[model samples]
Target: MLALSQGASRSAISRSNKARPDYRGSAFIADIHQNMSVTERGHFMQTKVMSTLNKKGVKAMGIRQVLPFKVLAADKYRAIRNNDSLFDLYGVLIGSCQYLTGIISARRQDELVSLKSSGNLSPNLNPFEHENIEYNLIFKLKKSGNGGKISSNKIIERPIAASIAKIIWRLEAFNEAARSQGLVKGKTLDLFNNLDARMCTLTKTSVKSFNAHLDSICDYFETPLVKMSNGELRRQYLRQHQLRRFFALLFFWQKRFQGLEALRWMLGHTDMSHLYHYISSNEVGDILNGVKATVIVQGVLNKDGELEKLKSIGELKATLAKKYNAGAVIIDDLESVIDLADDDDITAPHIDQLKAEANLESNLEELLKTGEISLEPNFFKVTDENGQVRETFNLAFQVKTV
Candidate 1:
């Protein structure tokens, strides 16, 4: 039945596209084909499916899911280490790598499984010797679709954060351990190879092993179950494809800071329209507006916020107050701003100006030069003469005292 529905959806898309070459409505249909509940697929042939699926798919994890998962995975890995359980440790390590790498690199499962020590997805230790990059995910094959043809295989390298690089290095060490145990021969062909089986590399069929490890970690962590649209609750399993959407959503939100062109290149897309389509139906703008409101409101409340003195914060506040008939009381609170941020009527022209005025990379470079911020593995620490940490900031522009 699922196969028939998938074929029907494909046939429908082909016919619809032929009928109207300019029609792009079927862009999200593939996502729907995967996410539609068994009951929903009964009506899969209906005209409404296209419209509903346009903005719908299996939900991806937000920061809430990602952070806790990371912490839990770390704890589990540490626990397994004490028992000297090599196999269990390997599971946790590979699972964490796959999950985080999916989010960080936005690479498809095929590409991820193809990662090797000397092939695609190679690591660069002395990246700074050439570029300023300390670590990078170098890819030998990129799946860039141009007019439905795969682009030439080229050396595509993306700078990964230090924390992620540490894990990749750990995976290398795990490979060495596996070799010592006679699990494999020389240099491993795949970074995610199954150590228990000699010369066996992880393929698309082997994805469950990765997710099973992730599930164990999440269950151990006692993370909340996700409520599905069908009114059934289930654990939020980190799937391979959802990683791309998660990356697109977060990158779209941060595109004001990091250019869209950069994201386009990182995603291996030949067309900007394909990248835009990824977020068009995904409520990307809504999430970003809420994020902006939170930042601006927090800046207004916290005197020490990174964006506290920005002119746009004042303008946003004033605009919210006038547009929503919100008194000072309402605009001042984070929750109130969140409530107001969803409305399509509220628009802040000055918010556009904020993007031009604030360049995060430049600000960080300046701060580093002036010794106001010291880089850490996970975050930037600001300290005083006594060496007591004053404030901490992450890439998300969040400020907190430790």
Candidate 2:
């Protein structure tokens, strides 16, 4: 009897131990479901509250403002999903625009007419002023999608609304930056030119492409020349002209205009002609020439040292090519002369052949001592400042025999 009691106790203990883990897992799953249910309920409640507020003619302004029509429509859809009875009422009200249109029945039409005549629709209404009433009603009807339009009309209009909002935001930011920086009002041209320079360099686009981009910016601001008075328009045009000139100067200074030297020369000469035709001919050329000479001298100095290295490399390569003919003048230590080789001539077939023959290895000791053609090393090592050697392998290049 004692042995039977021990076996039963052991079985009970084993069952209790197995049941504890299952209970813990079930508790975990229940907690997850509870959390999801709370989240869904909270969202539904918030949506319902927002819809109620919108129906009461509340307008929310500022950056956080949502369109009333969209908020109400979303709430209606959510209510339908939740099988709420209020969804039927919302559908009926939205659908019954014939009553609002004064065409439902004779009695209802009479009532609507009476409401309009008595100014019940709008108190203190000027009966003679039909324009504003019509405009407001039409605008409201459009917002409510009463013109046989889908509910998604509100969502479709959002991008246009968001674009306008973004423009306002940028204007606010520009105003704040200008105020804090103590920027002068008349220097808009300078500010625009600086922005243009930065954008051109960053985007790596041409001047014409950059100008097209600027047109989009102006369009976003709604600052078209035709919209302003003659004086204001002239000012804007002059500012843009000055901005273009500034960009040209920036391009010239950055050596980007090197590819179009002839165009630069023409523009520099054209400036002199402008002064000559408007002011004096003889003095203009002399004055402009002085300014042009100064710019040229500055440019020459900036480019002089680099120009010397390029000329030296070009002459050396020309001499080598003439001497070697079809044979390769291998530069085993090519990297040492890479800065010189970057000149335009290195792209020539002869120079390319020489580069192809040359072997580039981190460890050039073997080729330097042997003085013969050798394959580049597959791996190399370099000693650090602490005298510890670190090894590296290169798979990009391998030894080839010709």
Stretches of candidate 1 above 4 Å error?
Answer: 1-86, 118-123, 126-133, 142-152, 185-188, 195-205, 227-233, 255-259, 268-402
Number of the top-ranking candidate, with lDDT as the measure: 1
Candidate 2: worst-modelled 10 consecutive residues by lDDT: 135-144
Q: Each prediction's Cα lDDT score?
A: 0.46, 0.29
My TM-score estimates for the predictions, one after another, are 0.41, 0.13
Evaluate model 2: give its lDDT: 0.29
Per-residue lDDT of 296 in model 2: 30
Where does candidate 2 clash, by residue pair?
none
* Model 1 clashing residue pairs (backbone): none
